[model samples]
Target: MAHAAPRSGRLTPGKRDRKPDTDGSPRVSTDVFSERTHLVVRWVLPVLAGLVVGYWAAANRRSGGPVTGWNLLFGFTTALAFMVLCVAVRVAASRMKRELHALTWAVFLGGTFGFVYAQTDKTALRSAVMAAAVGAVVFAVLFYRYYTHEDAEGHRVP
Candidate 1:
């Protein structure tokens, strides 16, 4: 019997490699963990952040005092409120124009900061002014980022 020739790396007229073409474009993620990661980021991270903020508020309010039922209640309540408002703001901002979206987050940040600051015995006027300044700065920064990173149709630029 005659022996056949060994296969080589060269491409033949009737055969093509199964590997996909790589044209330097981004590839879609096929990993199963990606969806789980997205879910955790979209929900769990925000909840954890809210809890941290709540703890900070409670600690600031306590001011070296021992932990009490009232403190726990206040902290959990603040956490719940913060989470709800965060979700609401995210949903609302997603549907708004770019300007409104930036403004929404700015307002949320400023209001949350002001609330936390007020726990430190600061004057209401002082907290308000600080919050306004913070909001202005946040708005300017976010607006510029969104304006540059998104196209006219609001889609993100690659």
Candidate 2:
């Protein structure tokens, strides 16, 4: 058999040509900003969301009343509480097993939703019942996802 000339000016196949760095320093990834961007998105997006939720809750509580210092205080307090809970849940869930992680999120989602719903002048018993129902639904959905995505040892499958 006769050999043919290598294509694309490469003597060897499957080898990539790399350019030397102009500054003589080690090459850095082009995606260096991705990690920082992810960090900002992970925290900042949630904080923004918490703030929106807090505003909604405060508005609901105000019930068309004029904005007052107390109302602003309540909104800020609620926003702080929501942001704290979001961070806590994220950290705790990451460290927990699949079941516990799902449960943690379910509880958080249900409780937050219920609390916000309750601000709409709903009765305490109604809010509790709604929370329970929401919790159950969230638990079922999260448990299903976790079960499908994790193995028997609770390790995630790629």
Candidate 3:
């Protein structure tokens, strides 16, 4: 009987001896944990920063005035304007990311509390606390999604 042929090195998965492609080698996917770390670094920090600064600014501006009902309306309306302006800019740039929308939403929502501070000044601290709490919760959700999400591009309709 004829002897069986030896397997070629090229057939080996890791030890392939083929010439490298001209463009580039195939990208080796890293482990899941490593990729998640990368996502956290890329997506988490800026989110926290936006929340902190946005909440602090509005809270810091209050100076202990009364919060009349009109003040509440005005505060929310102003924050709404700020949000609309931000959305327009973000939309124009065409750089709108999921997190960017979240950040803006959090800011506009949180900024309403700041507006309240500007008007009534009473419970400025409470508004700040509430905004911070909300911002924290929002980021927590984003962070969880970042680490646990299957796709890197985000917003996969589950």
Candidate 4:
């Protein structure tokens, strides 16, 4: 049998020859501004969310009176604590192989709500029950989102 010459056309192009996302897909170009913006958003958004939750908690948990020094102190303290939790959640999410960010946020929100409710001279049991119920719903929705959007190995898929 006679051997035919190897065809170069059948092989894929070298890395240098392949253009970036020229195959009809939208191409995302990230510059320094984009990168910085992403970083800022990553940190800032969480902090802002934490601050909001903290304020809500403190406001609701306050004694029946106008805002006072103690209320301000409590709000600031809660805000600081929530900021820490947010940062911790960010770190945890970065380290996880699976999607758990939603769970982390849910826990924070639910716990804050429960704490504030209990502080209102309400029954601890009732506060806990309400928090659990809210947390469960949040968890279910977020878990469903994670499940449908991510594969078993945690890689996102369409």
Please tell me which predicted candidate would have the highest TM-score against the true structure: 1
Candidate 1 per-residue C-alpha lDDT over 84-142 given as tens digits, one digit per residue, 9 for 90 to 100: 99999988887777788899999998999888888888899999998898899999999
Question: What is the lDDT, from 0 to 100, of the residue 113 in candidate 3?
Answer: 46
For model 3, residues 28-146, the per-residue Cα lDDT tens digits are: 32233454676676455445544444444443444445655654554455545555555464454234355664565556546544454444445767768877777667656754654
Q: Residues 5-86, candidate 4, lDDT per residue (tens digit)?
A: 7433323222222234445543333222445667899889878977787778777777666988888888888888878877
- The CA lDDT of each predicted structure is 0.81, 0.81, 0.50, 0.69
Better of 3 and 4 by TM-score: 4
- Residue 86, candidate 4: how far off, in angstroms? 1.2
Instruction: Write model 2 residue lDDT over 1-158, tens digit each, in one string.
Output: 89985333333323332543565543333332455676898899779978998898899899999999998888888889999999989988977778898899989988988898898889989998998899989999998998998876677653
Give the TM-score of each candidate: 0.76, 0.73, 0.34, 0.69
Worst 10 residues of 4 by lDDT: 9-18
Q: C-alpha displacement of 84 in model 4, angstroms? A: 0.6
Runs in model 2 with CA error above 4 Å?
1-33
Candidate order, TM-score descending: 1, 2, 4, 3
| Overall local distance difference test of candidate 4 | 0.69
